[model samples]
Target: MSSTRTGLLLVCLAGVLWGTGGLALEILRDHSPLSVLMVSAYRMLVAALALLVASVVLRRGPRLLALVRAYPGRSVAVGLGTAAYQALYFGSVTTAGVTVATVVSLGLAPVLLAVVDLVRARHRTVTRGTLRLALVLGAALSGLVLVSAASGSGAAVGTRPVVGLLLAVACGCVYAATTALGSTVLTSADADPLALTTVATTAGAVGLVPVALVGGGPFVTSDPVALGTLGYLGLFTMALAYGLFYTGLRTTRSGAAVVATLLEPVTAAVAAAVVLGERLGLAGVIGSVLILTAVAGLDEPGA
Candidate 1:
């Protein structure tokens, strides 16, 4: 396969892995949502450690260290955004139902990001293709609304009502900004890929430590299944997924990259139906198709 095709494959794989988080967490529903948060924290921690070990084993420690030193500030900023996004996302899932929270959070992120991109494009005129992509995004969000209506379940996930929604929106915003910032940092630093992953993951883990502390220790399950799931999250979803996403972004346009990442929700919906045996009503199914179509439209050349 050509390089672009290979990058696209990696990007889609990353989206699929990310989408699996909800289903994986569902398997551990008996645990506290805080436990989910702790698991996420630990995922980063483990991912960072694993990458560090791999770097050493591969005799790339010097290159990794050089990159870390060169881009310390950017790494810290990206880490902070990543940490906040994860915490708020887990918190949102706790406050809102998984499907509701995931839809709202992920759906709104690109909208906010598009607005930001438009503002940034003020100096440079917006292209017709961008406008078309925006329309498709709007259609996708409309589909989310329809899907949400079809579900008909209304139990709040968190203690704070409005605050939870606000936090979830904030999480979306942070994620959008982080994607933009991370791409810039990675390109400018000319860093060792493994080292950057390790630094960002470690930084995110460190940020989550206080939340883990406040929530109390022995944060997650000792059970083999739960531990195994968390391990997959760390090794594949958090580490490998993000690494592939960044690599893909290096070869793809930002707009196309965001649209491609929408595959996460499509994968999540399918997983929910197949693994969790959750039925999407007719409206939900229609909405899913519309959303997928819109996203595919956005991925068209020049869109």
Candidate 2:
């Protein structure tokens, strides 16, 4: 397969993996006394440790260190950005419903990124192709609204929606900025493919140290379910997910990359239906189609 296609597939899979995060984190919180910040701290710490082990096993530690030393600013920005956006997202999930939080934060990112893409290609902004791309984004966003509406049935739906919406918007903006910049710096020909993620996650884990101390929760869980959930979150959603995202960014446009990850909310909605016994009514079905269609539309040359 073409590298671009490979990148898209990898990013989409990352989105799917990320979709499970909110639910898993929520479950962990219920069983443990971990605060949002604490959980985020654990997440980054675990992801960093896992990547460190991978680097040791692969023997790329020295090269990655060189990359970090070579571009300290980029490394630190991406790392802190990762932690900030995640903590903000978790906060949004707490105040707003998960479905709503997911929709707002993830949905806003693609729109912001598309704007950047258009500016970068200003000469093409008035073309017919550009109009079609706009329509596709509109459809996808509309579908997301439907999905969000369909996904809200749990106790966490709306304790403080306004606060959640604000937090989510902040998360989206931070994430969009990170993706735009990260795509440029996270992939390098000489550095290990995992270099950027490893560095960023390690920094992020360190950045969250104060959070871990302030939030105060046991890192050691006796419950197997909580332990497994933590592993899934740290490994699948974070370490592996980000590795795939940046790798995909090597070939995919930032705008298309974020949009492809729109699958996240849909995946979350489905997980809700299956695990939480929530209903996916007609709106959910229609929204899913629209999102999938929009993602496919982006593959066209003009888009």
How accurate locally, in lDDT, is each candidate? Answer: 0.72, 0.84
Candidate 2 runs further than 4 Å off: 155-161, 187-191, 218-220
Candidate 2 local lDDT, residue 158: 65
lDDT of 2 by residue, 85-157 (tens): 9888878987887777778888899999989988888754388778877987898898888887777644457
What TM-score does candidate 1 reach?
Answer: 0.86
Q: What is the TM-score of each candidate against the true structure?
A: 0.86, 0.92
Tally clashes: model 2. Answer: 0
Scored against the true structure, residue 296 in model 2 reaches a CA lDDT of 86
Best model number under TM-score: 2
- Native-vs-model 1 lDDT? 0.72
| Residues 1-303 of candidate 1: C-alpha lDDT, one tens digit per residue | 656556666677788889787677767554444466677778788787777787889888887678677888887778878889888877876776555566667777778767765665563666886778678787778777666555434435456546668767888888888877776776675666567777788888888867777877566566777777777878988889888887776665454556567777667667877876777678778877877787667545545
